[model samples]
Target: MLFKLLLLGLVIWGVYHFFIKQKPIEHKDKEADVMVECDKCGTYVSNKEAIIKDGKYYCSKKCAGVEQ
Candidate 1:
């Protein structure tokens, strides 16, 4: 009986690990993206997130001197 119980428990654990359990998540590396310095604040921001104005990079619209 103990052997059967152990086998059932093993089967359940296997099923949970193989099907019911969540997969390991993969994260993006910030270091892999290009970083740019903001012209006004000199803050370093991702190239994708930085705002471009007059051939310079800015961290935000306010730094770029945009009214809106």
Candidate 2:
């Protein structure tokens, strides 16, 4: 009886370790595709999150100026 219980416990532990306790290793890049430049500050930023106004582009509102 004790031997059967020990075997069942070991099997359960092995299954749990294989399925639940292991994490999958996923490798991917989370970068933007297009690159843009700020008009005022002349800083570069990704197009995915850059701010745009009228016909010009800037990294932020503070960088947008009258010269640009």
Candidate 3:
């Protein structure tokens, strides 16, 4: 009776520790994305989303002087 109870408690503890009590994984070394400034409007934007033209960065196609 005591052995069964102990076994049940151990199983519960194991499940809680493995599934419920674990912390989510985080990337510590992941750096923030770089920001670029538009040459025409001086607006700041993420490098990944900014428009590039003639070796200069712009916030939009119109600012970059590209017709679209």
| Candidate No. with top TM-score | 3
Residues 1-68, model 3: lDDT tens digits: 99999999999999988765444422322345568899999999988889889889999999999999
> What ordering of candidates by TM-score runs from best to worst?
3, 1, 2
lDDT-sorted candidate list, best first: 1, 3, 2
- Estimate every model's Cα lDDT from 0 to 1: 0.86, 0.73, 0.84
Name the better of 1 and 3 by lDDT: 1
Window of ten residues with lowest summed lDDT in model 2: 23-32
Comparing 2 and 3 by TM-score, which wins?
3
List the lowest-lDDT window of 10 residues for candidate 3.
Answer: 21-30
lDDT of 1 by residue, 1-68 (tens): 99999999999999898764444422235445689999998999999999999999999999999889
How many clashes in each structure?
A: 0, 0, 0
- Model 3 residue 26 distance off true place after TM-score fit, in angstroms: 15
Candidate that beats the other on TM-score, 1 or 3, i.e. the better one: 3
The most accurate candidate by lDDT is: 1
lDDT of 2: 0.73
How good is model 2 by TM-score?
A: 0.44
